[model samples]
Target: MEQPTLSRATNPLIDALVLQHLQKRFPQSAECLQRELASRDAAAAAPPPTNRHALLMLLAPPGDETPLWATAYAEVRDWVDGALDTEGARYKPELSRLLWPLFAYTYLELLRAGAREQAGGFFASFHADHALMRRDELNQLSQVSSAEQVDASEFARRLLTSRYEVRLSAFSRALLLGFVAERRLQLTLRMLNERIKLALPETLAPSDGGGPAAVALEDD
Candidate 1:
């Protein structure tokens, strides 16, 4: 028997109609067409390639004395701070507020990891930048040298347990998110996803009003 073959016209509607007709007239070809359709659909639905390096690095056991958390934290923080600092002054205030919470959590995360020396260096390097807004909290947090201290201190415990909220204009939120995604800063992304709560306002009001918006700040 001569088998029927479909001639693809490239028009979705026409192709579907032809496929249906072929299937009805030739039951054997139906299975082949169905498989092809399934393959195409699966390909279309597959997710884009993701950079899993950061996630893997975070989840993998530390095989050496390297302070992965502290290093990741510093890279993410410095990039974010530099990013916001370069933005227009108008959006700077709303976006820059993210730094404080990020800083606090990064420092605490280092301490919790038993990277006391790394944590101290991190604190000293950036504490002054946040001192104006979080001086007392910074001072108190600096005293926390280990995970045991974090558990015992009320201030440290509260910050770790609670989510820090930040509002951002929709545009600002997109810009920030796009930057992180492009950079593949998974640790920073994890922090934003798990620890920070973002409040996105629909419309950013100029002057008087406005709106919008990792490191794998994780524990062992």
Candidate 2:
């Protein structure tokens, strides 16, 4: 079997010898290296990150450069709730699952940005609605009042460092994107784009009008 090329700069003979030794004596190390290489390649092929804040700034009126994040957060929460309430039972449950993550992340972001009072108010306003569903997480997050506290909390670390996965039907996804775009909901758009990994059915067709071929929210 042909060995995979590890690098271009290394001598092939030396590379082959090193790989063979590692594979024989430290098989796990060889496997780890292969996984790392694959991860790097995948990251390289990924698209550039969207500067949602900068885009929001450009869209804002001349005197209002800063986003009213507190207001925007409430708008997104209400819109999502109302939209899902009207959705058919088939898709409503799955779509409604988004609220917990949205609430948690928005709160963390507000705290991270040093908006302690807004974060507290945001928490108070929405905590009851999610209490039954996410009681433990809400409790843990409630204790976090500052950026330092957020960093120190294990729950916050896990939530911030990883993407939450949600499955959505093509129609549901299209509806979400349309509403987000129409409302110019920057915070919601940023959350969907950056933190959520949407899984769509394999049989999705182009004519479905799902914004993108990939199961991701479009930046534009």
Candidate 3:
């Protein structure tokens, strides 16, 4: 079946604010995303387990035309459905595995924002964890490791790289308060993306051939 293409103009004000946060706050992580894009070679793709489907559905951001959530929902949904068959069978993992690495970028940004510290701990609340895992029995979900061997430096590098690539998703990059506070903008964008990706619907991914499609929210 053919799908509707949800394209639009970029919002410079929003983009500019986002960039400002990334440049000033999470400089290192922003750099990493940029580097990965520039190299045209990303870290190895991680295999998707059965539980990921639920994560995608739950974390998906709520939007269809905005760049970050829209693109992320589409990409994540594409990866999950492509992994399953009509009879609900499993297929070997593919390059779509990039999603895991991408989310790792999100995780890094959140750490920079100090989300853990804000909530009185260094990780998300156990309640949030339970909600995310309930989707797949996710008993093994949290136990699973992120795709890359990440550290603070690596996170900063990826984020900066994405900023330079200028193709980042709005869902993944936009956060609460919309950059009123610069200190945590980078991490806030990252976490918002992660949460929205967790809530994505299955209809987001495109069916045509192209590099993975990204929704640019700015109006041109």
Candidate 4:
């Protein structure tokens, strides 16, 4: 089912007001708004087009096609499911650690995609996943709902900019990346590039202490 779209055109006066607000209140993103208008079907009826037919286009400022979070979230969700399934099960414990960060990123991606309401819903639907181990991070992530909120929340900002520590033996990392890459899970690759750092050991030997372990962050 299609999610409702937030952007729209209105009656002439309201349309002008919307344009003015975009240009005046968000000058930096104004160009994106302009390009959004420019790239649409050039011949569509002006005042009624967005309101009538192309609301999803409003969700993306201009060039981006129905922001990735809109549809791809489900794809990425399924991809994660596949990555943790029988074929990839050997790395399940190590890969499991990425879940919390991936969970946080899902919300960010939804926000960046301009699916604010959807982001909230997505978060609510999965809130139970935040167990005792993830309480702090979960609390921090819960405070964020928009792009500005991300900048304001230190934890949210770190989730976006810092490297998520994925502790795994070298062989596991190779297997995971190689499988995803070979399978062409593009969104998973994007997640790795944007949200995590693969933390490996200095030596390839098995951990003297058993297997890899998650080190608590200074804040945690």
TM-score of each: 0.60, 0.59, 0.23, 0.54
Highest-scoring model, lDDT: 2
**Residues 137-164, model 1: lDDT tens digits:** 6788778878799889988887787787
Error of 3 at 139 (Å): 21
What does candidate 3's lDDT look like per residue over 143-198, in tens digits?
32333322324433444344312222222222211221222223224443432222
In what order do the candidates fall by TM-score, top score first? 1, 2, 4, 3
Q: Which residue segments of model 2 deviate by more than 4 Å?
A: 1-67, 83-90, 201-220
lDDT of 4 by residue, 1-220 (tens): 2211113332333343334434543443344434444555565424332332222223223445334443444544454456344544544555556566666777877776777888888788776665566776678778888877777877776666666666655444544443443344455556665566656556433343212355323221
Better of 2 and 4 by TM-score: 2
Cα misplacement distance, residue 10 of candidate 1 (Å): 31
lDDT of each: 0.55, 0.57, 0.32, 0.52
| Error at 110, model 3, angstroms | 1.2
Deviation in angstroms for 38 in model 4?
A: 52
Cα lDDT for residue 13, candidate 1:
33
RMSD of each: 15.8, 16.6, 17.8, 16.6
